[model samples]
Target chain A: MSQVSQATVQRVTADLYVEVQQFYARQMPLLEARKLEEFLETLTEDGSIEHRPGGWKLEGRQQLLTEMRARRGDPEQPLVEEISAREARERNVSYYDGLVYRYWFDRMHIEPVDEDTLRVRYQAIVSMTDAAGKVSFEPTTVVDDVLVRIDGELYTRSRIVTHDSPAWADKIHNPS
Target chain B: MSQVSQATVQRVTADLYVEVQQFYARQMPLLEARKLEEFLETLTEDGSIEHRPGGWKLEGRQQLLTEMRARRGDPEQPLVEEISAREARERNVSYYDGLVYRYWFDRMHIEPVDEDTLRVRYQAIVSMTDAAGKVSFEPTTVVDDVLVRIDGELYTRSRIVTHDSPAWADKIHNPS
Candidate 1:
């Protein structure tokens, strides 16, 4: 990691910085909105994510899609009222209410690995706001991402996430 | 507002969108770091902010600087141990610990008010992360900003912020 940091730390151009930021801006919201298919499109066909704390990896778009689909459930199927009520009770919210998660990425440092690929490291803070408007944070994580330029558009090639704390180590579920 | 939205809703070019996002991306970190002088540089000399909930306005760079100075105090003067201890007690943190605020701006909608100026509206969510890593959110806000291009660089000419909820109406202190 140190060698990569020292040897390939190319200065990110102003244009490229903005382009990368915009890419995440568009991509993360799709995940938050549960637009799984759209979110998957932001990654390469062989894109992968490694959860360091969980010691698990999801490789390729098909595997990624399968995991995400299982996590998000079938969007076409409406939640049963009984299950909704049980979830509400478990979450301490009204029957129809749920948590809203907002992901904020900051302190981004970008380094060029090659002409087509860049290494991007950033702090990912996930804030869960409940029906009562209270916000709580998941443990902060530092994500190292490999982004590739494909025909002038940016896509994630791979991601490695390391949590800053182990409090939620057992709860690692999200791909990003 | 509707008239402006309807009449001037020009499609934001990819270049312009990236430019606008980049402008805020650079401008906001200055504020979080309490780099008031540098943050002020991102605004026009005659830039103004109107707090809709508070019904108070700070007009021009001088006034904005004065308010920020009061809020941040003199960085040159070190805080006495007694005062630091008191603040720690008040914030329920260790003697040297403090809260870190992260500002996230999202869901931006940009419209060309004219050739030289654009009206940008976005949701601003401020999260306060404590030393213990607990995060709480301030009431969300919708900020409408008028940005003008000066010598090909973007500068904020004016900002109007409307709180989404009244929870923090009386606690509004920061300029952004």
Candidate 2:
């Protein structure tokens, strides 16, 4: 059974799978930190993202980054502010504070297009930790997108996110 | 290069991919003809489908089929008539004769799960030939779904379709 599974992975473009997995891994921290500008840099110039269940859409990196921050706040009073260092793991056990947001991906499926492009889909979960570290979980979201390689770098060309519940921002930032 | 492509296929469970491709290929004719009952059999006993950009959803084969036909109308006045066949095709060429809706799939991507499951995504287009044989096209729709092998046969577990424009039914039956 293990051998068959390994064979399946070998048959699939495991290299590209690992590359994309790492891309998402790297992305989470940036998104968690509200690094919208950095995240914007990871998108193609003509990229567009549409979020259903919330009806929010952003096209192009410039506007995308601006709106991402605006959705958070006036930069100074952003949504969730936290120091993500090893910060005394002992002291970071509270679940209540300002706001907490974390995103993780699984059930990943990818289709390799040539060697420079990948069309990927995955399920993502959003978890929140308040200023005091009180945590709450949001429902999993279905994410579909295209990743393109340009000039030896990878960037997202398009993304469509569907939430199982309501808007992601509303669930996390404006908790009931 | 051919060897590499073949190797990728070998790794990715090529048999399953072929099965799913055939499934969708077979599905097109059934769907284009509005064979809802036959199409219902292609879904699992507990299947669900949702159409986005319009937020229409259906769960369970019974309700799904019922709502599908209901959305069209009573049996006498179906939204689309059959014409894929030759004589029937010729008889139904009048733009004012009846409503005609057709669906075609292309640019399909598949990922195999074990030996009996596949996650597939594809782009589909809808075209209609009115009673006068005047044909019009609806916007392309992005489709994503999972197919599971049940009792040695394949059945779709879930399907989500996102339309690029308005719904096909609205565009045709209620054309402006």
Q: Which prediction has the highest DockQ against the true structure?
A: 1
* lDDT (10s digit) by residue, model 1, range A6-117: 2432245667877888999999998877787899899999999887754568889899887666554432343323332124334443222254677878757677777889
- C-alpha TM-scores of all predictions: 0.56, 0.43
Candidate 1, residue B66: Cα displacement in angstroms equals 3.2
Residue A101 error for model 2, in Å? 1.4
Q: lDDT score, residue A55, model 1?
A: 53
Worst 10-residue lDDT window for candidate 1 chain B reads: B77-86
Candidate 2 Cα errors over 4 Å, as ranges = A1-11, A73-97, A166-176, B1-176
Note the DockQ of each predicted structure.
0.06, 0.02
* Best candidate according to lDDT: 1
lDDT per model, in order? 0.66, 0.60
Q: List chain B TM-scores, each candidate.
A: 0.77, 0.72
